[model samples]
Target chain A: MTDVVVAGGGLIGLAVAWRAARRGLTVTVVDEAPGRGASEAAAGMLAPVTEAGYREESLLRLGLASLERWPAFAAELEAAGGLPVGLRTVGTLVVGFDDDDMRQLEALHDFQQELGLSAARLLPRAARRREPSLTSRIRGGLLVAGDHSVDGRAVHAALLAAAEAAGVTLVRDRVEGVVVDGGRATGLRLRSGGTVPAGSVVVALGAHSAGLPGLPPVPVRPVKGQILRMAGAAGLLDGTVRALVRGRHVYLVPYGEDRLIIGATTEDRGFDPTVTAGGVHDLLHDAIEVVPGVSELELAETLARWRPGTPDNAPLLGPTAVPGLVLATGHHRNGVLLTPVTADAIADLLATGELPDRAAPFTVDRFEAP
Target chain B: MTDVVVAGGGLIGLAVAWRAARRGLTVTVVDEAPGRGASEAAAGMLAPVTEAGYREESLLRLGLASLERWPAFAAELEAAGGLPVGLRTVGTLVVGFDDDDMRQLEALHDFQQELGLSAARLLPRAARRREPSLTSRIRGGLLVAGDHSVDGRAVHAALLAAAEAAGVTLVRDRVEGVVVDGGRATGLRLRSGGTVPAGSVVVALGAHSAGLPGLPPVPVRPVKGQILRMAGAAGLLDGTVRALVRGRHVYLVPYGEDRLIIGATTEDRGFDPTVTAGGVHDLLHDAIEVVPGVSELELAETLARWRPGTPDNAPLLGPTAVPGLVLATGHHRNGVLLTPVTADAIADLLATGELPDRAAPFTVDRFEAP
Candidate 1:
């Protein structure tokens, strides 16, 4: 029997398992193929200020809180795992091409200012000065100097290593369902006709959370996203460039020496993993429109994955009505952004049996009756 | 000792070896990795009439001669190899998008008419009737009912099987250079520190022909090309759509049920094999401009290879200046189209020491100073 068993081995599940095991708890993570889900496709943009919305202030605060803990978390994890997490604090530039896009950026900038976030609006020339690879056709932009990014794949890898180092048992098999007895969550039923008995179970299956048996209704839905990874762009840009070409949104994040992460298209087409040509064309079209030099880089890879979207695009991060079963999935596009905070809060709950004050508002019960 | 040793196991070499073996000559082929060069990247367009130019009448005649042999060649090869060659004779449509493109199409049509080729100029509506997926923005087009195509990879596979089945020895070793003694080519020195002795040697190394030692200057240069293969394009186009978008040229060839071959860019950058972003962007942009539905297909693959180019853009067939050293390279963009004729002509020459009348004009001695 384990002190805690995690149903998925993605970044979220592995992070929670590692943190909990470090706090003197026996942990087990069960996944057929860990980190091959949304964790593998993330661009790792941790831009809470630039990505903040009007009515989602609490989510914004949560993102800011998570962003605040990233540096320390990355340092500790690097020490524990002996691997680099590829964290960069070079900031992000959000630019707009046309009048409508400019108005949208202005509105977002005003909102960021009202929230007292650290962002500066820039004209086309100023934006181009900040990042010379940007074309001169840009109208205006907003530079969020505090919003940084990390490499998502690297973080997942480091988490796996750290969890293994922390003595977290990794079960390379699928979790078919949660084993419940007497109206309390007890263990996980494995696909290989076995069961993992645990004091608690953390369901962090991301988009698959909605379909898992023996779990209550999770309002999570699979939102498909198509993205491209390009190489041979050694000096194309200094940092991340989020742009609105006409009315569509696209972002280019420079990673490593010659790699650029160009993404992505959010489609509501339910778990379809085909990287469509239109998705690639729209991404490249807008990316090239904002930065013409993008056309000269090599398109190294194209991928499609699902983001576990909630009704309000905020993650569910606390205990559910089921007693021993906790919910830690539905980070959506911000799984990489919110990794540190989610791990700390979930591991803290497992240790102290109480959800943290900052994480209380995001409980799954908020979506249930009153 | 073998009767013949061919250096290079590409479509040209394998086809020659297969045909010569069928004519009672023991043959051996030497290559490091067979059919992974320009043969794998060829778009397989046999469009001699639609691709006709002002000064390349002899090349056009040679293309027509090979085109005439394709049906019988494909049938016999399929019978010998037990594989489909994906040969489609549904013809091709040469389309134009803008005024300059329309003028160029009209000039090409005039030249084809002067040469008494079978081609008809069509209005945009009539062109759309042939390939309904073509965009309505097309200005005009030329319908060449004789132009055809084959799947290059499928042809390579079939040729491999046919060559193997015909008892031609396949040596999976790189050819270092020709082996010459007493002023006559004897065999080939291999990269594996071994040699393949033969009665005669055939130099069919494509772009690498110029770099082989112990052989005279072959006048071949590498012309780099980048191409893409896309899937999920079932029923997108009937045959092939060769379009002149603005001043640039692009082509889309359909293979199987759901795969489309979109190509390409011609650059003189030697042997650089990186598939540039500009090349992909231009291809997708022009393909979408010609057929809007192209944007919805999946980009299955991207590849870069080099074509063996000559001064006159015609092949250097028959014997070279070196005795017992025959030449069958420099097919350029027309290797797949000229495969059958090249095989037959070279095999005929090997059986009897006389170059055919049609193939005699393309000898390497033509490039020698008078």
Candidate 2:
């Protein structure tokens, strides 16, 4: 029997399985579409606070912790996979246009200060000074120093490579059910009428985690987002900037040599993920507002995607009610941010049969109604 | 005399021209590579709230206004081009897991309500009951009803058809510079040494607007975004659901027939629009968290593109400081959402030689102070 049977082959699952295999545990990851979930479509922004607003502190903490581990984790993955994961600690600048936006920034700054985290700093002209591409609409800004970013898709590829390199079996099959014997997960039943036994099972499904049977019910949901991309002169902006210009949330992220990353729109209307004229129009309009020079760049592509979300907006990690079933799903926006932490935590849990304190808050049991 | 000479053939430029032409004004459009740009790469979602929050009220207002006009605009385009623009007003839902996440939902609801908008609603358990696929772990949700969506690529095709049908001259050549007669814009100088004379000019170059010279400086900057597309079980999701999930900012948009739209990451490193391994991995991970059944889907495509950005994160619209040179660049993130408004506003401005109230806040004058 395999030491671990990962039900999904997403970044989280593969990272865990790869880490487990490195610890001399036999691991098998079962997924029909190995790299076609939310993990593949994500923007890979490793910002914990930029994504946090009201009370997603737990998730923010987890993301921050994972962000702390990203450098080392990415290095390890690179060593195993012989690839660069595009990990960078360039920091993020949250800029505002007017008084109301500055108020919002101040509130966020106060919250960050209260966390005893040196993640954000207020900027006046310093924001535009650091990145000259910024227009002189001249307003206040918040610089999140601790937060960094990575290429989510690259990390996914590296994880898959690392997992295979570490001798974890990657099987392509849809998991239909979990094989439970006496309230313990023994294996996973495949849709093709096949079963693979394991000493432990972990469900690392992203948005689709709810469809899997025989688990504590997960409140995972699908959130659709659309993004636009363009190609221009490289080195347009120095670091990631979340523009609070005119009370509109827009971002300009540069990723090596004439490419800029801008996105996205959130929508909830079932599963109609089609690129729309209105979506494209909005992206261009706002992008132009932030960097006016973008009007001259060549647009490379536009995309729409879905992100898997949990009830608390925190990932479901560590042990479940089932004895041998460990849950590692529900990492919505921070999947890339939490990748390193997830791999390390799941590996530690599988190795010692217990979760660390950092992962305790993200336990699947948190979803229980009680 | 033509009031504007739009210097691009993509959806944004064409839409502006189509609207301008409809306003009983002579308009000429020059394009090097028409029908490309973020318009080609976008998965259109007309969700202002879904794309809201970076404190982008101007863009949100613009998106809402355009969304209000989308149905009629799409119908007009259809009437002109004899093709459907794939416009649909399917609302969006932003869901949360627990009390902490509920805070974000509440904040969004409050903000929407404060905006005097009827598009958003706070959904309880009963609201989620309509879709059984939604996990029981949902704490609550916020639904944005007025937000709609469409297929951008389809609209691009239809816009070309409509533009040609609207008597707008479509020129195929790279724009070298603006032809200025007596310090007033007259036409475009092609890269092949051909000059196309016009009464005026509109620099609707999308991300590439900065590359052109002898026009108003748009200050357009390119932002890159990467995305992945997958084909899942047909009719997998009921509508679009976005989650401020786990500090990762993820969403799942279903585009009919088992195909789900998954995406994207924001990076500012410059113009290498190649699909990376990490992007695919992160997208898959997040997607599975919301819909566990997607492991059974197939990955159809992976894409990367750039978006144009401006200084204040708002688009530059209306007339420029240069005589006879109207500016319509710097539309970074809200290009798609602002298509209708942009088109109508440009048309009105061209016909009446006066800027509309909606275009006042997004003027190029805001960037002139520096």
Candidate 3:
């Protein structure tokens, strides 16, 4: 029997499987579709503060800790995968356009300060002068120094390679249901009618977690988001700028040579991922307000997807009511943000059979009513 | 003097200039990087109702008219450019998961019926039986017969070829400002300090119009989005499936034999166009949920871009307050959808200096405070 049978092979699941295998545990990840879940559709922004304000302080603390651990985590993955994950320490600058934005920025700053977090700093004209591409119509800006970013695709690739190197078996099969004898989780039944027994089962099914049978009811839901991708002229944008410009949320992120990442509209309108004209219009209008030069860039692609959001918007982690079944799903917006921490936490849990403090607050029982 | 000097050579600007030039009017288009912008990133989803909302009736109507004119437009463009824009009339199927989704589907169905439009139909079990690969979990679907799609990149390329063939001078110049003399539009001053004179200037700048100074204040905003381009296992998804499966908005647009377009997220985080971990995670999650077989496909590209949007969520077309400047900005998401109409409308206005009825509703006056 394997030490752990990861039910999904997305970034979260694969990372856990890889870390557990590194610790000399036999790991097998059963996923009919690997690397094709929320991991593939994410922008890979590692901003704990930028993504904060979801009313889950424990999850926020865990995310902040993961951000702290990201450098080492990325280095290890690079060493294992033999490729740079484009891990850039370039800070994210959140700028404001008018007075109302200033008020919002101040509130966010106050919240970060209350957390004893040095993640954000207000930037004046002198700081903005460092970046010449910034428009003249600037009020003030917030610099989220601790928040960093990485190439999410590179991480996914690295995890796959690292997991394979660590001797984790990645079986491609649709997990129809979990094999449970009495109250303990035993294994997974594949859609192909095959069965594989396991010492433990980690339910990391992302948005599809609630649908999987043999597990206690998990409250995972899908939140639809649409995005657009464009290729800019080389050296178009200098650093990451998250702007509250022209009364709209806009961000300009530059990557290697001529690629700029732009995005996303959040809608609860169940999984109808058609590229709408309205979604596109909203994106372009806000983008141009911040960076007029984008008008000159070539549009590379337009896309849409669904984020796996939990009721609380925080991921469910660690142990479940079942003895051998652990829950590792419901990482709504922060699956990419919490990847390293999740991997390490799950690996630690599998080794010790005890939940870590970092993942303690994200228990599946949070959604259960007394 | 030329009727108009378009400040960009993208599909939006060029199509407008081309239509005007075809109508026995002299036109010049100034573009630093022509045939780019969101036009290059777009998959050319000509879907109006597929992208419609209860409030977006006007935009939907405009999209429907363009969809009706698309076949003839492509044919005309092909005739002029000796190149084909891959325009397919294969209707889109918006798939649903369960009873709750059927309610949303019914609402959209009701909306379609109320419009007296026959382009959409409700697909039941009998119709869905034709496609066996679709999961049994699907309760029902909406068939948008009028909503079609095109290869947006191909259309952009074809437009360039067509524009060149139609005797329009495509000059490579970064327009600095419009040369206004005596409160009348004269020409454009280039970044290179050169000047080109014309009778009028049309700002069809897509997401970049907000930066061009000395223009009527048009509230253009940017909405960022991300997408993934995958190579399916030779005919994985037949035609386009605009899926509303389980509240995850996803589109499985099939491009030719193996390429499938899946996407995106709407982010108002300013022009940071980096493809994030979250974006990838969400896209793959929904893609797998909608079409369980997509996991086996090879991921070709993970891309992101920003779309141009307006306040009212509709495009700003027709005349501006500036005498020599005709405002054709703020098509936002429908830039691709309104390409034909915009081109035709702008060309008509340029030749006769009269606003066509089709372009009247989209006038800049709509945004002016009463």
Rank candidates by TM-score, best first: 1, 3, 2
1 or 3, which is superior by TM-score? 1
What C-alpha lDDT values do all the predictions have?
0.93, 0.76, 0.78
Tens-place lDDT per residue, model 3, B212-261, is: 76776778887877877776446565557777767767787776656778
lDDT of 2 by residue, B1-370 (tens): 4556788887779998888887766667778778667776666777887666657788778877888888888898999988877775667777776677778777777777777766445565654664445556667777777666676777888888888898888888888888888888888888989877776688887777785778656788887767656665576666666765554655666664566676566666567666643454456555565555555465566677777777777788888777777777777766777888988887777777888998888878787778
Name the runs in model 1 displaced over 4 angstroms.
Answer: none
What lDDT is reached at residue B196 by model 2?
76
Residue lDDT tens for model 2, A122-167: 5667877777777677487778876677777788888888899999
For residues B1-370, what per-residue lDDT tens digits would candidate 1 score against the true structure? 9999999999999999999999999999999999998998999998999889889999999999999999999999999999999999999999998999999998999899999999998999999999999999999999999999999899999999999999999999999999999989999999999999998999999999997889998999999999889999998899999999999999999998899999989999998888877788888889999999998888889899999999999999998777899999999999999999999999999999888888988999998999
User: What is each candidate's fraction of native interface contacts (fnat)?
Assistant: 0.75, 0.00, 0.00
The 10-residue segment of model 2 chain A with minimum total lDDT is: A275-284
What pairs collide in candidate 1?
Answer: A295-B278
Q: DockQ for each of the predicted structures, in order? A: 0.71, 0.02, 0.03
Better of 1 and 2 by DockQ: 1
**Candidate 3 lDDT for residue B122:** 48
Is 1 or 2 the stronger prediction by TM-score? Answer: 1
Best candidate, TM-score: 1
